[model samples]
Target: MKKYALNLIFVFMTTAAILLNAYSCFAKDIAFQSSVDKNRVSLGDDIILSLTFTGTQSIPAPDFTNVEGFHAKYIGPSTMVSIINGSMSASITHKYVLIPLKAGKFQVGPVTFKYGSDTYASNILTVEVVEGPVSDNRPIRTAGVPPLKFEDKIFVVMEPQRTQAYLNETIPLKIKLYVNKLPVRDIQLPQFAHDGFSTEALDRPRQYEEIRQGILYDVLEFDTVIFGTRPGISNLGPAELDCVLLEKQRRTGGIFGDDDPFDDFFGKYTAYPLHLKSNQVSMTILPLPEEGKPQNFSGAVGSFDFNLEADPKYVKAGDPVTVKMIVRGDGNLNTVTTPNIGSQDNFKVYDPQFKQEGNTKTFEQVVIPKIETVTEIPAVSFNFFDPAKKQYVTITKGPIPIKVEKSTEREGLKIVEADAISRPLVKKETLGRDIIYIKELPGNLRKKDAYLYKNKLFLLLQSILLLCFIIIVTLNKRRERLKTDIRYARRIRAPKEARNGLKESKKYLSQGKIQNFYDTIFGTLQKYLGDKFHLPSAGITANIIDEVLKNKNIDERVLDELRSIFNECDVARYAPTEVSVEKMQNTFLKLERIIDYLERQKL
Candidate 1:
């Protein structure tokens, strides 16, 4: 009886060991692995958390009750069956869409499932929720991918080459738009407010493709050059772009098929106004070194080559000679001044006429040699701060040799005049003489006029003559005042100038020169106001007109009409759009009425 009991115990132990080995082998074949589409996701962005089970198709749906910090939704199951070496294998992948409620790191799994009396637990997945959407090209599962959000598909970036720069140094700035599967239209060019810098836009935008975090995106790039005028921290942007998003219109079918005819008649396009702006970027601009600054530097900060040339090497005294000075290279050529040609005592140098084309600046200066002894033109020197070399460079050019001959005509005329004045007077012999006889008669003519002088008609004629003389003198004094007093001259000529400009504009209007017509009309009004108010014509803006006319007892209606005319002209000039003929004519007439009213005003 004892042997039989021991044998029974060993058989029971062997059965238990066999069962445990079978369960271990089954567990090894079946894997419950959890993975996420994206390890990092933005708040409000949906994440795909998939629990994949291989080696068996009998798995139950995963329990996501323990998942926290996210709204979880079951996205149905995807199954794949494969036959390898005549052995059938299957996988069941259960997907859940998880939208993070807040920005934090959260775990998605350890999802438990029971199959064949065995509990299988998937690996826990750690997901990081970021503040902004992830810019990546990761493939999104069909069931979990959400609709494209504006912040996700399209964005603007204002990127500067460097955030730190020296004062007056050129900073290359790039304003770029990244697009991913979004259609846009009616795009207005980007703009930014650069108050403290000298800014210049480059050529038109360029299109290209770039990859950001595994996502391919179309990029539109705009380039610009900026120079910080002052030293300190300067804010660059908040670059703004205006565009219209072209969204696909949904087709609506009536309760009865093919019944809605109105839907077909209407265009199948919908546009949403989208204004995109980039974040502001700050730059630290350091002031240029003052220790080695040249005294003659005129705020030039670029690489440049200086050249000086004279047109005619030989010329007569008192004749005009042109000195051409050219500055060529890549730099801020707009602010470059003419090189100091040294004291031009021997040559009368006028102001240099500056002309710029591309990277070259030419200064055409007219100089007249006064003295015949001057053998050479003065040496020209240009001083600039070379930012690349970090030093002050003085470029000295030649004392160009030239032959200056005395003007023979002037010298000869002077000698002749002097000789004529100093020569003694020659007495010519008097060959023929004429004799005249004088007679004394006529006493009867004087007595006849004595009675007429006392008549009333004669006194009346004399009074009329004196009145005419007084009128002539008053008119002469007024003309003199108009010439001497600038304010009075402008006020007097304003009306005539406006009238002339309007008449000229009519010809342009007749020839379909819309731009010229608007320009003429705008200039006429601006000049009329400028002269009447004694303000600078160049400084006359819409705001200035309003401010100046506000105090003048002008009618508000007239002011409004005037401002409207100015605004229209401004739009036409700057925007250059098609304008109607009737609109142009009406604007002309309104301007005339405004001028007439302004002329009648007391002030």
Candidate 2:
């Protein structure tokens, strides 16, 4: 009986020791920590802000009122329990999706939370809100559909052709939209506010596809010219682009909830407004040199060719003559002026008429010789600073020679004769009759009753002729399409080829010949890309395809589909794996979709 009592005592002590150890573990110091998925993020991007409580499982939600510059929402709480070395510990993490409102550096938390008898404040986290989304490199995983990633999908970038330039020099700026798999619409043109530079109006947006970091993206490029007005550090911009994205919507609270298997198959899409912005770009504008400056420089800053010419080299003293001076080259032609022709006292010079055609400017001046003694028009010189040569160049043309003759038509003609020493004079007499003048008008004006165009019958005939002309032109274009245009013929036949290829692929798929099916699909794609881009089949590589279609402005979704089909084909052909019928069917459907899309495209 004593031994039994001792065993009971030992059992009670063991139980008490276990309970105390558990209690000590629970009573340990509560550790509060806060973190973010990324330290820097764009204004429209989402940052996962988390507050974790360790050493306890009964944690109340953290109060995140201290988070600044962002709108935070409590997503939910996740609890994790683990047993390490026979000790049980737990951690509760509260996640908040933080959407930044403005761009700047901000702080999140020092969030305070309560668990049992202890109060804990999380560590502070610093985040930077930039102008665009942070780049995410993780591969996307999807069950049925191709994986789509936010970072690879759609974004905007601002780039300059050159970062350093001289004052008043032209700089090419390109703002582009990069899209991978997103359906975008209602795209408003990008805009930016530049303080120290003058920008030209953006030209039409150009569409193309580019491969960046092994991912192909459809790029919409908008080009503009900017010139720095003053010397110093000049800013380009924080460009902003606005568009709408058609994204899949998550369905909730119905027979078909998120967990429903049919959700991925029959998903509904909603239009979400997306605003993208690019970071500001800086440029250094160096001041033009002050040395070797010309006195007659007219602020011209590019290469130019100068010439001078005069028409009607021989002219009466009082008659008008035209002298033209032309300067042509690539530069700011608007700022160019005619060179000064010194000393106008020998002639009467009218105000010069200036006309600019493209990169050439002509100055036409009307000059009348005031005296017969004047021999030539004075030489004209043009001086300008050539930035390329880094020197002042003075271009001088010839002093055009002119023969000035006395005007005989100013007054009646006069005849004079002179004899020296002794002279014999003979007198002659002649009789002349006065010429008779006509009394009638030179030409008869025969009047008609009505104009041919004013007649109703004539107008009806003309309309009929115009209708016939339109019909004939239309028929001629159709005939030309059938006979002369090879590209048109190819385009017309492309759909038929695609259908035949699809039929062959379907046959192979039914027979369970995976290699043959993928090879056929691959060949079809190569042919399609080649046909659409007018490229050779042998040269149809992924990079070559991207290059060929870069200027075609194909849609991002179509490009993504093409890339996925290619990748699937490559894997099925080279890798030794069991290709499922469902995957082959998906690939076939994707191919059909791509073919249909390309057929509808204007390329």
Candidate 3:
């Protein structure tokens, strides 16, 4: 009886051991789901693929190396533990965001985790990367419109307030990205072109929480100012974008998907690319007006007010007069001519020095003060045509009060008493005046030889000095005439100057002297403008040349070439990029062509 009982016990024990081993190998407490809303994604577009792992106990963290196709960024790692009807369950999940760098199709295999010698993996996923629109093949219907696929249904666009503008004109470029009923997250954006423009990204994209084109979509929008290089037609391209979208898998009752007594509330989420495009825009760069354009027009296009003051109106003969010229107004103050103090005969007026304070962005100058001093200063007038009112405006300052004394003054200004002043005035009326006229006593003055030898030497020295002055004056007049004539001036000096500039630039490039190259090009062009058009270095711009050429009736093609040269120099001045020898050579050729073309054109 004992032997038989041992055999049955052995059989039962063995059977139990076999059943336990089988259950360990095949049975699983962990569950999972894998899904993505989009099958295709564009470069820079975001996609969300969630992995949910549920088990009787905590699941082990996943090793993501198996899915090597993705450039993954960790979104968040979370765990949930719940108890119901005396049953306990727990899950640990990790969410990741992935972006593709290029276009192609990729496969992401089953994500697996191991815990206590047990291993588990989710279903395999496949994603397609395309060049164009990024969206899942989901139907979207709104406001009696036919069902539309997500890619076909939504669009983002940019609308510029004005397509064409003068160089530096602040143009409002607005962008809006919209779709129907999609959860969205702003993604990384592409770097736009910096073609002679400064850009500022607004604080946040304006979000409109509404539906458009019958589909509920997040409308994301922003604005930027596109400044042109100069007054010429230029294109501000389409603002491209990337976006993240979440699709709720058609939930019936629960917070996420279909509600069921045992069904945990969860939604399958994915990311889609938002491609925003704007229509090709053309802006008419209204060339700056050259007719009646003031020679001193400091490129200022707006109206402004000017004021003048002197530190001390009354001063001794040799005392310095601090004449302050303050021009303040809402206009192009920087471009306005520094007011000239007409003639400096009595007062030795040094160059009218200046101090300017203005906001170039607003085209306003708060204060541009110029100071000069003299014992006596005549009143000077500044003339400006008020464009708004269509009238000539003039500002004049000072017969300016002055203190008069001997060449050397021992005392300051004295106030004469009323009683003393009245007595002198009464005596002047009672006194009779006698006429004392000295005629040019012709040759008799020479007849009375006083200090004959010294006087003769003085007269001869005076004659020689006078003769020299006449010769110097004649030469100065001729030089001024040559400088004043644009055609003659350029014909005389442009070739030599341009050649020197090109040669120096080449030298600088060979020696790796970038700054010197920039200076040479800029100075050469400035000197060219000064010589050819009589414009100052500080006043060179494409618009200025355009107007001048138009007035002179130069060929339009020649003007275009001039603009190209200016643009090239401007790029080298501001851009932090290296220029190649080929590029420099090309630029040199372009500049030479422009100089030659303009030189030949009759003006």
Candidate 4:
């Protein structure tokens, strides 16, 4: 009896211990977060505000009554439910998204929330409102120019041939580096953004003798072509140049065991500082037209000529005819519409295979001969408008002739079914069968309901569609919220974008295409700038970037690092001296480090 009692007690204790362990492992039921635009806010200027929370239990919303010198605007609230690591968890964020109506030296009182009978309050936050510039309390230095480098005054200008173009239109964007008072050494083309367009270099940079704005300038030009994707507006920014400026500076240095304190602070020292800066250029984007467009219109842009032909115009009815179409011109040949082959009663048509060649400026294609058989092949025509001539041109083919021939004789085999009248059912006789035998009645035949609701598969499909519709609606709403909250969206994707350029550069190097390798690098960096500052690359210049960075509260050290990396790439690529493979490889590796460091840092 005592042993049985002891066993029962042990089992009960084990159960209790297991329950306690499970309860202890449970995640905290509440989370807290707070954010504001400026620690030292300015009066009359709006400061953004936000709040975040996570919990499993239902919690009452907090009150925002009688908050001093602060007004709150309730943009909205959203909840995100997710299963993380085999555990059900949820987060409900209540955003104030406030724009302060008035500001002063004030304290925002602790926010109180009720969870069951317990109350929780956030810590009070103090803010100072000032009228003058929000002092960042950082030293300001002149944009430094690196010594022994031609980059201090050197810069790049990207002039796109056309900002507005059709889907397959050839865009010849020219990048010109205009040498100012500084001597001409070399210039290189930066990388580009690849989304929504296909790109190819027009030609190697060419040197030209030219004068601009009453001054003789040594100019080098590079060109490229871009094919827009769809009928929608987009922006292409200018290719940025990072030039190293060689500037001389005097500074004080320290020595080991120096007795003089003044020598330690301002010991005379001469050193050259490398000044770096990233410059951006912007271009306008225009969407292609879709309305009144032809069904078979290929994505061809620019001017072109069309020709149709068929080998062996005369053939037997059973023999196939090969109809070929050749489109050649300066415009987009790859995207040309399929030629219309006139329909005939006795003829059957098949789709033609297509092939294309050439870069952006000049594209060429040939549609393989479409095979078909006919009693008589009729005339075919193709029509298109000529922009340069300002008139319509229509090309036509002849009404080809075909001959019919009787079939060759076969010895023994015979076709079973020819025509309904040609075949009659063969009758068979069964002997010794007196009484007619009836098969047992088949199972009951029931008519199925045709109504949509009665179809199980249809109902399931409808439910899936409905769920998709709900998801789309939710996504649209979230997009609107993100648009309104620009800062949040930028924080998520900016780092990845910056790192993408350097990573792509490595790939190009592995492929052993030096020019393309550099191009990818520049393109990636330009994309980062656009995403970083919310400005199109076309409109950004070194001066513009410097100004924006100043406004962004970025430190001089970070800016210097950015400038140095860009300068190294530009000078190395375009310098009059040839860039060795070893030097290029080294620079490529350095660029990776620069990008990684920039991404890990906060601006």
Candidate 5:
């Protein structure tokens, strides 16, 4: 037993020595270098610049005071510790998102840092800013130079190809978002209010850069088609869009070191939500003209080409021949109808099959020659109103000749179901089997009720329909209440928000971030109370919360707990010092319990 114990001790000491030797390589070289995610980026595009310290995670971030051609925003620091092949190494990387302001090739820092008696300098990083948008295949609409508005940072515009269009004529609509040097994300689809018109859904937007008044702006355009439905003056906008904007702002005081030189560079990103609305567009919708209107004219208001083709033109009598009618061009093909083969003496026509792809619509039908004398197919006319010509046009095609040979097949006999002579049919049975009277049933047969309400399947289907209607009504009412009832919506959102805030506070606490923890805690309590009482979060104060809850006969102990937390958060955030982990845990628990108690109250 003693020998085994000695062997175990010897193994443990050997392992410890190996681990220490491996980890001692962490600070051996103390090398610093800089790199970027992209060597080439488009103007107004974002690139990441990283300063990697290949020595230790304890090094302070170096200043990027000489970053050219791009505005630098310090996001955060990342640390990595790895043991590879019995060698332990650690590194700290500081990352910055660089938004290019101009088009040029620029060099980023040879950043220098001093530690102990040694100094380290990072290598320079070169980045090229291309003059246009990122590589995308979709072509952007750059014809209209939209005037900048609202500080020229961000705006949206809605423009139509023409202000006036004939009824049933299609107009190309463009909705564009111009972002000039502003960092934006989460762009929503624009809502275009097009009354007195029919519209197609907006397709995927094309992104590119356009120059306006000697300034470059990033453009995202949505192209869609719309047509006037009725003749009159119509208004078509107040186009609305929502997006989130990112702006660099000073940190609202965190627990991190205040004397750090990189604080300004490491400023926080604040999101400002924006709703952009474009002006309403008023335009005249001209009615279609009445002169020289074709008798069979349909509302097809664009240029089009028509063709007719027949296959198996030499079929025998009673054999089928397929004829295809194709109409292709820049028009609403939905309004183009199949041409009728008009009255033929010895031909039978069947319903045609229709297919549409891109700008073409094709109709195919099978016509059988009933007799061998059918010399040709009849002619049919297609009529449409051309908005460009402002007149009606009619195109006629057919009289397609074909060879129809008579079939040599034998004829079959036809069956006559009833005798042509109407002798008393009820009393004329000569066979052994007795026949029932024509006008009446046998006495043994029972009659069935023809009322539809007696059906079980019908009743079941109606019950299911009624249940579905009730469910839909309930959901619709709930949606409307959420939209219009502010207090109710807030009350519903209170618990989820409280949970999220507490979760964030707990994360900060674990990270040893004292000021952030207090700030999150304080904000959480404020938002919770504000939502619970249906007040603004910005106006919520400890005293106000106390008054509000006290009026509702809240427990004094709960109020005292709330007051203590609020005061602690105030003190810790403004005059932040060391706060114990145990204290933070206790504060978190108290906050959670108080929130639970308040939520349980009817008020």
Candidate 6:
């Protein structure tokens, strides 16, 4: 107990010293800077303007009551603190959403903040607003949303690059989630109706600010490529997303004033599940034109460049020569097959190996000349429909010159003979030694298990054998049951699965993908619980803390920690900046503790 107390005191002092060092670095310099997430935005799009103050988190918010050419709304401030290798840095960023109202170039202010005795100023930023829609800027305003303020605080929008496209043509799709200065968390990926189109998993969503209807909003955009399988006018996507919306009850103040930059960090908000959906879009997918269609067109719809390469123009009979075919450009390469080649009768052709890297598809084929008379490799032809040209394109290559020489070597077997060496032998006495003589007197004889002590020893040996048999039988039964009972097997393997998930989380954290890292952590917890208790993972929720674990012999402290972890995960899903690295590490430790506890308990 004394040693444990001393260890705890040492940890406390160490943590305090580290934090003191980290924040002391923050006391040295105060840098005030301004930057915009985008230099240009569409008339209805939102621009994110950030005023960052380094070396301090006590700065007051900038007043933007009247900003020209754009409607400004203050979103919350984000604070970041870090200490690596005893090198400390800290900053607090005050971000605002600015919506452009007209088309023109305008210079925004060198925003000034008056905090206590110090007056801080930021750099001026120039922005340009454009008419119609924005192509260069990644942010876009929802096309059909009404200009007036609506009841919904959050919503989603879907946009397809083209309304009419050829079958198998790649379609770039973008889906955006817009939050109008609202506290939201636990945002899930959007699901949409896609009956005739095939799509890949959505790319990682990117966050930015946008303004719709004089209100500034935070936007998350998800992008993916889709291909149309059937040709016809099809309605795609009334897209939907599930998120937890937070409603602020009131401001919870800190040591600083009411407009404290740390309010968001310590603010309390209640969360409620919200669902959002977008409008449906009608798209016409046309089949390739039949007039100029090639006989070999295999549903490849895009402009492509094809190349055929053959190695070893000169080779001996029965020697293999390689043929490499590469098809590269825009479009769906998964639908493209290997191009056709001639001279199959003259050569022995093996199965071709294929690989795809981005837009390029490759085929490596080996062909051996059966006879020496074969002079050239056959010509290769590839057919694809060029949507831009509105015609079928056939790329023809090869018919190169080659030389085949007759094999000069002959096959035969030669006999090998072994040489023996002769040696002189010694006398027969040296090869064989003399025999042994028997002892005359015999030792005392004893019968087993005759006396009291001997009987006890024999019984002990039998008891040991019986215990070993029982252990072996128990282990064998467990092994057979594991093969048949999936629930029991999962329960046994829960700890290992949780450890693997934590490993993946650490890797993502190192890569600076905080959202993915937290996602793995949350998923790890859910999967761990499901596997440990034999519950379906999809149905696991925070309510289960009482419903599922109330009677399980879990300690009150562990249950409280589990509840805290679930709450933090809910908040960290969308608001990752509010969650610091230290907090995440603590969360990891807590998760390990919970898993360890559950690992020792049997359900």
Candidate 1 per-residue lDDT, tens place, 1-603, comes to 456446655655565556455444533367677777667777877877777676654453444634688888665454444332244445566667788888888877677766445888877778888897665544432334565566967889999989987778887899998877565656667888787788896557755556655454557788989988899998988999887676656456654355542342232667788889998999998887888777777877778899989979889998888999999987677668878887788888898898899889999999999989989878988877777787777889988888999888743344357887889998776655444456687446544343646655546555655565565557656754553344676788789878998999998888889999998998788778867876545446689655668878888898789789989999999999999999999998998899899889889
* TM-score, predicted candidate 4 vs. hidden true structure: 0.33
- Looking at model 6, report the run of 10 residues with the lowest lDDT sum: 136-145
What clash pairs does model 3 have? 164-283, 179-217, 180-215, 180-216, 181-216, 181-217, 298-335
TM-score of 5: 0.45
Pick out the ten consecutive residues of candidate 2 with the lowest summed lDDT.
Answer: 137-146
Kindly report which residue stretches of model 2 are placed more than 4 angstroms away from their true locations once superposed. Answer: 1-152, 248-270, 411-603
Candidate 3 per-residue C-alpha lDDT over 1-603 given as tens digits, one digit per residue, 9 for 90 to 100? 456446655655565566446444533455775545354566666666666665532332243533455676545434444332234444445566677756777887677665446777778878876777654342323123366676644555667776655434445667666654344544434234445445656535544434444344545566665545566665555556665454445446653344432221233455554555544455555555555655543344345566666666555556566767676765434345656665565564555566666532211112212222343456656655544544445667764554544345366798889888677543434334555567776554444445634655445545655565566557555554443333354446656767777788778867866667766776677666645764433445777665556788877777776777677778888774787777766766777777787778665
> Distance (Å) between predicted and true CA of 183, model 5?
1.9
> Which prediction has the highest TM-score against the true structure?
6
Q: Model 2 residue 60 lDDT?
A: 41
lDDT of 5 by residue, 166-261 (tens): 888888999989877565666788897888989888987765556655555657788988889999999999789887777766554554555543
lDDT score, residue 152, model 3? Answer: 47
Which is the better candidate, 1 or 6, if ranked by lDDT? 6
lDDT of 2 by residue, 102-124 (tens): 99998776777553356677677
Candidate 6: residue 128 lDDT (0-100)? 82
Q: Evaluate residue 362 in candidate 6 and report its C-alpha lDDT on the 0 to 100 scale.
A: 98
Would you list the C-alpha lDDT of every candidate in the order shown?
Answer: 0.74, 0.73, 0.56, 0.53, 0.74, 0.76
Model 3 global lDDT (CA atoms, 0 to 1): 0.56
TM-score per prediction, in order, is: 0.43, 0.44, 0.32, 0.33, 0.45, 0.50
Q: Where does candidate 6 clash, by residue pair?
A: 46-210, 46-211
RMSD of 2: 31.7
- Compared with the true structure, the alpha-carbon lDDT of candidate 1 equals 0.74
